[model samples]
Target chain A: MKTSNKSVNQEAKNSFSIKGYFLRHIQVCLASLGRICRSPVSSLMTIAVIAISLALPAGMHVLIKNIEYVTSGWDGAAQISLFIKKGTTEEKVVNLKNQIELMGQIDKTEYISPTSALEEFKRLSGFGQALDALDKNPLPAVIVISPGIEASSPQQLNQLVESLQDNPIVDHAQLDMQWVKRLYSIMDIINRGVMIVGALLALAVILITGNTIRLDIQNRHDEILITKLIGATNSFIRRPFLYTGILYGLLGGIIASVLIGLSIGLLSDSVSKLSSLYSSGFELKGLGVDGTFTLIAGSTALGFAGSWVAVGKHLGKIEPS
Target chain B: MIRFDNTTKRYSEGHEALSSISFDLNEGEMSFLTGHSGAGKSTLLKLIACIERPTRGQVVVNGVNISKLRKSKIPYLRRNIGIIFQNHQLLFDRTVFDNIALPLVIQGLPHREIGRRVRAALDKVNLLGKEKLYPVTLSGGEQQRVGIARAVVHKPPIILADEPTGNLDPELSAEIMHLFEQFNQVGVCILIASHDIDLLNKMNKRIITLQQGKIIYDGHEMAPKSYHNHENIQ
Candidate 1:
C-alpha cells in the first residue's frame, strides 16, 4: 500500500510538471498576442512601417533584375564608323573600304562616294540648291562599318581604327563606338547603386523590427519579472518573442512582395506602350522566380533577425527583479 | 527547496543590494520576507526568482545554484515557483479568466483543461462570476485576487508574493492574507514581501527582515527586536 501510494504521488508530480511545461509557452504567446490585439492601431502602424521599408528594397531589387534580364541580350550592339579626311581620293576610299570588308572582323561595310554623300545630304536637308553653288564637292567619302559580333568591344574596334589610321591614303579613322560603351557602363553603375541601396534598406527593416520587439518586451515588464521569478529560462521567455519576430518578418515580406508585384502590374502596361512607341517590342517585365525567391528569403530573414535582436537584448535584463 | 549561501548582489556602481544573504526554505515550509522599501526584501525575492543575478556567492533552488544556471534554465525553474506582484500585474487588456489561465496555458494544457483549471482558480479567489470581466473593471482588491488566482492557477509548489496587499484596505488585506494562508495549508510554500506590520502581527507565519542589505531578523510570528530599526522599509 505504501509503495502504491508513493508511486501515485510520483505520477501526479510528473503529470503536474509536464503540464507546467506546456502551459508556460501558451502563456507567453497569448500574452504577447493579447497585447498586439489590444493595440491594433500600434500593431498595424508597426507592420506598415515594416512593409514599406521592405517594399522599397524589394521593388528596387525586382526592377534591377527585370532590367538586367531584358537588356542582357542587347548589350553587344557595337557600331563603328570609319571617318575619312575631306581631301581623300574616292579611289583610295574605295580601296580602304574593300580592305575592311575582306577582314574577318568586318560583317558588312557600305561605301559612301563623295558625290553620292553631297546629293544625299542635300536631299535629306532640303538644301539641294545651296550645294550646287560650290565649285568642288566639300564632302568626304566614308565607310559605315559593322563590326562582327566576334569583335564587338570598343577596344577591338579602336585597334582596328588605329591600324587603318597608319595607311597613307586614309587621312583619319574614327570609330563611333563610345555611345554603346557609355550606355552599358551607365546601366551597370545604376544597377549596382540600386543593389547597395536595397541592402541598406533591408538592414533598416531589421532594426525597425528589433526596436518594436524591444518595446514589446518593455511593455510586458511585469509578466517578464513574474516569469523570471518562476524559474522560466531565458530561452523559454524569448521563444514567443522570437516567434512574433518571425511572424512579423514573414507578414511584412509577403506584403512587400505583393506591393512590388502590384507596382509592377500597374506600370507594365504603360511600359509596354512606351516600348512599342520606341519600336523595340520591349515590355516592362517583372522579376523571375530566382529574383522573387531572393526577395522573399531576404525579407523573411530581415524580420526574423529584427525580432531576434530585440529578444536577445530585452531578455538579457529581465532577471526576476 | 531553496538555499541562499552568502549570496550578495551589488549594483553596477558597487551599491550593495543584498550582502551575504543566506537562508533556506525546505519543502512545504512557508515564510514571509518583510522589511522597509530599501531593506533588500524585494531584492531577496528577486534573487530567489532568478530575476536578478547575484553578484557574489550562490543561490541554489531545487538543487541548482540559480546564480550558475544558464539563461535557458530559468524558465524551467520558474515553472516550479509562482510569483504575485503588488501591481497585480494582471493584463488589463484580457479577461479575468484568461489572466488566471495564463500559467496553465504556459504549461501547454489542453483547452478543456485550461477551462477547468481557470474555473477552479477563479472559484478559489471568489471571482468565479467575474471571470469574463477585464482587470480594469474590477475593484483594487478584486484585482489582487485575480493576481492571486493567476499565481496559483498552475499549482506551483512555491509562491512569491511582493506586497500582495500593499494597495488593499485592511479587510481586503486580511482576505488576501487568508487566501495565502490557505494555500500554505495545502503544502504550497508561500513567501510574501510586505511592510504590513499590523497584518504580519495578525498572521502567525515566519517573518524575515532585511535592513541595509542584511538580514536583521527571522522571527516565527513578528519582527525580531533586532529588526526594530528597519520598519521604514516599504
Candidate 2:
C-alpha cells in the first residue's frame, strides 16, 4: 500500500510537470506577443513587409486557380464536327451518333440530317438564292460531339477525333486545333510562371523574416545576456524570439489571406459583368478555408525556420562573461 | 561548495588572468574574495559559475567537476548556483516583480509558486512594496536589492557576487552584507568579491586575496585584529 501510494504521488508529479511545461510555453508566447504589441511601429513595419511578400505568391496562386476555372469552362465549349459521306442515309447517321455517344471519351452526340444541314446553312449563310439554284442537296449529314469534361484536353479530343474518323460513315472529323493548342500552351506557361514567381517570393519572405529576427536579437542583447546569467537555458532564451518570428509569420499569413480575399472581391464585380456579357455562369473564388490554413501553416513554418537560422548563429556569440 | 584544483586561465591575447590557483570552499561557508582592480577576482568567480573554463585545471561545484561537463549541461549546473553582478543587470524594461521572477520563470515554476517565492524574496530584500516599479525608476540601492532578490528567488545552494555593492553607499553596502549574513545563516554558501578592505575585516570571514593573477593570501585571520597572531616577519 505504501509503495503504491508513493508511485501514485510520483505519477501525479510527472503529469503536473508536463502540464507546467506546456503552460510555460503558452505564457512565453503571450509575453512575446505582448512585447511586440508594445512596440507598434516597428512591429507593424515588419508585419507589413512579411505580409506583402507572402501576399505576392498567394495572390498569384489564386489568380492562376481562377484562370484555370475560366479556361475549364471554355474547354466545355470545344466541339468535334463529324461530317458524314454525301450519300449517307439518315438512319446510318443516327446509328453512328448512338455509337459515338457510347464511347467513354464522348459526352453526347447530335445528329443533323443533310436536309436539316442545308436548311440551317441556307438560312444563316445568306446564300438561300444560290443554294436554291442547285437541283440536288449538297450538304453532308453531320454529327456534333462534345468530349467528356474530364477528357477535354487538346490531345484527348484530337485522339477521339482520329478514332471517330475510322468509322465507315464518318467522312472526316474536324475540330479547331489552333486555338486549343494556343490555350493549352498559355495555361502551361502561366502555371510554370506562377510557380517560379511563388518560389522566389517565398524566398523573399524567409529573408525578410530572418533579417527582422536578427534585428530583434540585437535589440534584446542585454536582456538575453541577463536571462542567460539567470540560468535560462538556450531554448528558454530562444523561446520569445522564436515566438516573435512565428507571430510575424502568423500575422503576415492572415494579412495575406485577407489581401487575396479583398482583391478577389474587388475583381469579382468586373468579372461578373464580363461573364454576363458572354452569358457565362462562371464566378471567381477566393482562397477558401483550406488555402487560408495552408498559407498560415506554410508561412509559420518559414518564420520558424528563419528564426532558427538567425538565433542559432547569433545566440552562441552572446555570453554572460 | 566549490573546489579549484591548480586552475590557470590565460586569455587568447596572452594575458594570464589566474596562475595555478587552488582553493576549496566548504558547504555553508561564507567567504570574501578581495583584491585591487584587475586582480582576477571576477575571473575567479566566473570560473566557479562555469562561465569561463580554466586553461589548465579542474573546477568542481556542488560535487560536479564542471571542467568535464558538456556545454549543454551548463545551464542545469548554473541553476544550482546564483550570481549577482556589480551593475545589478536588472532589465529596465520590466517591472521589479518581473525582474525578480526571472530565475523562477526560467526554472518553470508554477505561477502561484513563482508569485509566492518572488514575494518572499522581495520581503527578504525589504522591497516588497516596490514590486511593480521598473528598475530605471528605482534608486541604485533598490536596483541592487532587486538583483539580490532575483538571485535568491530560485533558492540555489550557492551564491556568488562580483562587487555586489560596488556602487552603493556605506550604509546600503553594510545592509547588503547583513542580508548576505542572514542567507549564510540559513546554509547558503556565498563567495563575494569586493575591494572594501574595512568592511571585509569587520565581517571576520575567510579572505582569499589575489595579486597579479595569483593567490597571495588564503588565511582566515589575516585582518588587522589578527595581525599579531602571525609571527613570521620579513
Q: Which numbered prediction scores highest in lDDT against the true structure? A: 2
Report iRMS (Å) of candidate 2.
8.6
Query: What does the lDDT read for residue B172 in candidate 2?
Result: 91
- lDDT value for candidate 2? 0.85
Which residue runs does candidate 2 get wrong by more than 4 Å? A1-16, A81-94, A104-144, A162-175, B223-234
Model 2 alpha-carbon miss at residue A30, Å: 0.8
Expressed as tens digits, the lDDT of each residue in A199-311 for candidate 1 is 78888888988998898889888777665554444665688787677767776777777778889899999988887887877676665677667767777788789898888
Candidate 1: lDDT of B180? 89
lDDT of 2 by residue, A216-255 (tens): 8998999998888777778889988888888888998888
Candidate 1 off by > 4 Å: A1-178, A277-280, A318-320, B4-24, B35-40, B52-59, B194-198, B207-234
Q: Report the TM-score of candidate 1, chain A only.
A: 0.65
Task: Give Cα distance to truth, residue B166, candidate 1, Å.
Answer: 3.1
Interface RMSD of each: 7.8, 8.6
Which docking band does candidate 1 fall into? acceptable
Judged by whole-model lDDT over C-alpha atoms, candidate 1 comes out at 0.77
